[model samples]
Target: MHKKAIYIMMLVAVLLASCSSPGRKALELSDNMLKTAPERALAILDSIENAGGLNREEQLHLVWNRAMAHQIMGMSLAEDEQLPEAIIHYREEADKQTDSYLLEASYLNWKGKRADAINVLNKGIGKIKDSTKRVKLMAEQARLLELQREYSKAAEVMERALELNPTKRDKAILNYKIGLNLSLAGDPRSEQFYSQSVRMATENGDTAMACEFLRNYADYLANNGKYRQSNNVYREISRMMPQMAGLSAIQMAMAGNYINLHMPDSARICNEKAIESEARLEAKGFDDISRRMVIELERCLLDYGDGKPVSYVGLSRYCDSITADMHAKESTLARRQEAKERLQWANHELRLDRQRMGWMLAAAVLLLLLGVAGGWIYYRNRLSRLAEAENSIDTLKRMLKETQTPAEETPEEKQQKSEDDAFFKKILLQQLGIIRMVASTPTNHNQALLKRIAGISEGKIQTDSLLVWPDLYLVIDRLYDNFHNRLTERYGNVLTEKEIQIACLLCAGFSTKEIGVVTQQSDATIYVRKTSIRKKTGAAEGQDIVSYINGIKAD
Candidate 1:
């Protein structure tokens, strides 16, 4: 039985090995497409992540390859005229990625954000321990500082990069950059560094790098009117790469130097040699488009220098191709801008949609609250009106019962009236106490109690006048029961809160001036309220509101 179980476990292990991990299939599919179709690979990777089948190792592979995909996307998408999105993707990829930082800094430098680009390089360098990468970052930072006109600081950075002991090829580039920086910093010794960089580039068989150093230094010399020295450097490059198509560039610069020095015959000879060298390089299978463009342009410049009519012949191919080159750069910039506008427009539309939804939601909430408030107000008013009507009917019945008696007053009626009056006053006191508590809050700034009381008095006249009038109505109903409904039913719905206050005070037999004092209203205000009540009751202008209110009967 034990041997059989061992055989069964071995079979299970073999089966497990035969099957793949959950995420492995998709990852393998993506890996196959990574080099040939990066965009499709990215989509596959994204789907795998969203569909959720990744193990721990698969997750790490996903992050590594996804970052690589984004880096490639930055290049291909930019070339495809999707630049803003491309740069954004590049920046996001660069954030945690050490290798991509240089690309991001280059973009920043092109944007004229030199300080920000340098800061990015500094942070990247701090994170990277690789000497080649550190040297590259430092050299770039030095170039940025030089562009900013901080020449000494630029030299300092370059000096630091040189201390990293880069390989021959990297040192050659860094040395050239440092020479440029030092030359611009007003150092005459920069020529030695330039010479060293050129010698090293030549020894390392990086003839192109050597040519770059020679060309830049020669151009600088020419610009400074050092024609003789610039001509020597050009001749040196011509000797180094005699059979290359690139010879046209050196001969052209040499011809320009000869022309500036008033050696027109020498310039003419160099121009002829440039035209001849072009045919040889073509025979040698040199297919550099930019170099050919420059060579043809120099051919044209040569004719102009020789005091001949500028030849339009043979310029069409290189001229139009160069024009396309110029347009390619311009279109790249325009596409970047177009991409930015598109993103901004999309974001703006999204924001507007969100704002519109928020306003709609707020309006919906407000309407719902208003509906609820309307129902509640109706319920409370209905209950109060009914209760006041029922109390008035009971009081009338009691009054009728007492009237039937000869002369004795009913104790129960007095007790009921007292209870009603007490209830009404209690509501008034409770409302006043709430007002006191609110007015006493820290929001009121804790002023003198007397001053606060005075402010409260003013508030009672302005706004709080309405709060008391409702309880006052209840008290009047308690005193005379159903008087409000009877008056309303007799008259129209013209009675307002102020009108009710006026009628109630008049029924209590208060003088107009005394009613004004009690209500915290001016005498003129009381008179106005009295007039309104009279109009509502349809009493004549000369009739007393108090007598009219007294004559109101429950029946």
Candidate 2:
């Protein structure tokens, strides 16, 4: 048992030793330093002599660090373009995509193909799912945009990068860079960003960085005619002056602000302090001619502000020349930016046109499908109606053959028969027209006409008694050779008026459901009425009601 316990202890120690191995420690260190000091990271990564003992993850990590370090340092993995081969060696998809995009973009940028580099980064930003990798790519893109003098676009991209959840230090740095870009773009919002950056740096315990940020913010205020606010920021920087550099420059800027505020005495005091600081710097053998020139210019400004009468043509000419040079540079930058904006707008418009064409094509295809479906339905309905018409014609022929004979008739009877046939045909054609109109249009007028026809057939329109079915019974009697008259005469005592109407509709070749619609009754009621009629008329079971009515000639 003691030997077993000792073996367990040894195993535990071996695991701990492997977990904190020297190569793994160096990998972590190099990765941390990749953004801050790429050259140092590359040297540390190169010092790894033996990677054979490392695990697979450690090995992949080693390769990734080397590739990234070289890219950051603006060098290639191989002098002859073997960098892409190294990039694809990563197996994990997110890491592989990140390295491939960032490495390629960096390579292109180094080769003086900044536009292609931006395109590659944009593609990667769209395709990469990892937020960290997207942030890295955006940072590179922002760098390229800055190089192209597109300060507004650069600031916009940096704002997007901050939303990707970078580290606190990175967020502070991003705010500072965004402020710098906005200041270059001549946007007033840069003051807000600068203030935010200073606040964040102070909270992060970066005093030197905070003071540096305050210096720039003060300069921006002074340039924009906010001399009082600029003086306040300068005082804030003076609180941290021991940790800051360029005291002489700060004093000169304060003197300019005082001079702008028309406080000549305060301006003279600041100028004297600046001269003293400059002398001290010169004593340290770190002096420049520009510092003396700037100090003399401040003295001249103080003399002019004090209303000293002096010849000032040389100073005016020198100031004009400097202002003209600044304006020329600004105008050139504006034209270049305008051209770039036009190109970007053209590309955006082309993409929008492609999307619009796709939507139009989809809409056209959908319309065509609907049209085909509607045409098919219409054709089927027309064929059904034609078949119904042919069956109706056959029924008329069969009735004529069953009822007509070859015997001669008197002229009076023949004329009466011909008039009844013409009148009945006219009524039938009017009924068919009303039904067809209702089927096609279903307007209120057409529906009213259909109901009026139904009322006429049911003998319900009392105001026009001659139009009722019973009043027209003479014409129907002659048309059917008095067969319908005899059937009603025999069964009229037992049948209701509703039942008689249903019987008339049935003999006219209307189905039970159609009869119900004409009479405004349910189909079940129509079926019950038909059964009652069959019983009362003594018709045999399994015989059709219409055929039974036709067979009845006399009681």
Instruction: Assess the local accuracy of residue 253 in candidate 1 as a C-alpha lDDT between 0 and 100.
Output: 72
What are the per-residue Cα lDDT tens digits for candidate 2 across 1-555? Answer: 245445544664565447438789899999889989988998887665446567767776777778788776767644426455555565346536787887777877777888998999999899887777788889889999999999999999999999998887778888988998999899989988998999999999998888889989998899899999998898888887653334678888888899899898988988888888887887797665566567668888787777975455645665676579679989999998998789767756775685478557655655554565566667776686555434433443333332333324559877665555445535543444433443566555654654555444343543232326674456566666665677778888999888877776665555664555445455688878888988999887767986787776532
Instruction: Give the per-residue lDDT digits (tens) of candidate 1, residues 1-555.
Output: 245445544665554443335357767888788768889988777654222234455565665555556555664222222333333444444343554566566556666677888998998888787787788778778877877899878878877887889888877887787778777777876777888889889999988889889988888788778999998888777677775434666776777788779787887777677667666766797645655555566556666766778765676765676589789989999999999889767766776686578557656755665566666667877786555444433432333234333433559876665455444434443454423544456645534433433343344324364356655666666576666656656664678766666676565545565344345566678777777777777778979765665576623
Query: For candidate 1, which ten residues in a row score worst on lDDT?
Result: 76-85
User: Considering only N, C-alpha and C atoms within 3 Å, which residue pairs clash in candidate 1?
Assistant: none
lDDT of 2 at 507: 59
Model 1 CA lDDT for position 482: 61
Question: How far off is residue 49 in model 1, in Å?
Answer: 11
Report lDDT per candidate: 0.65, 0.72
Error of model 2, residue 480, in angstroms = 99
Global CA lDDT computed for model 2: 0.72
**Model 2: pairs clashing at backbone N, Cα or C within 3 Å:** none
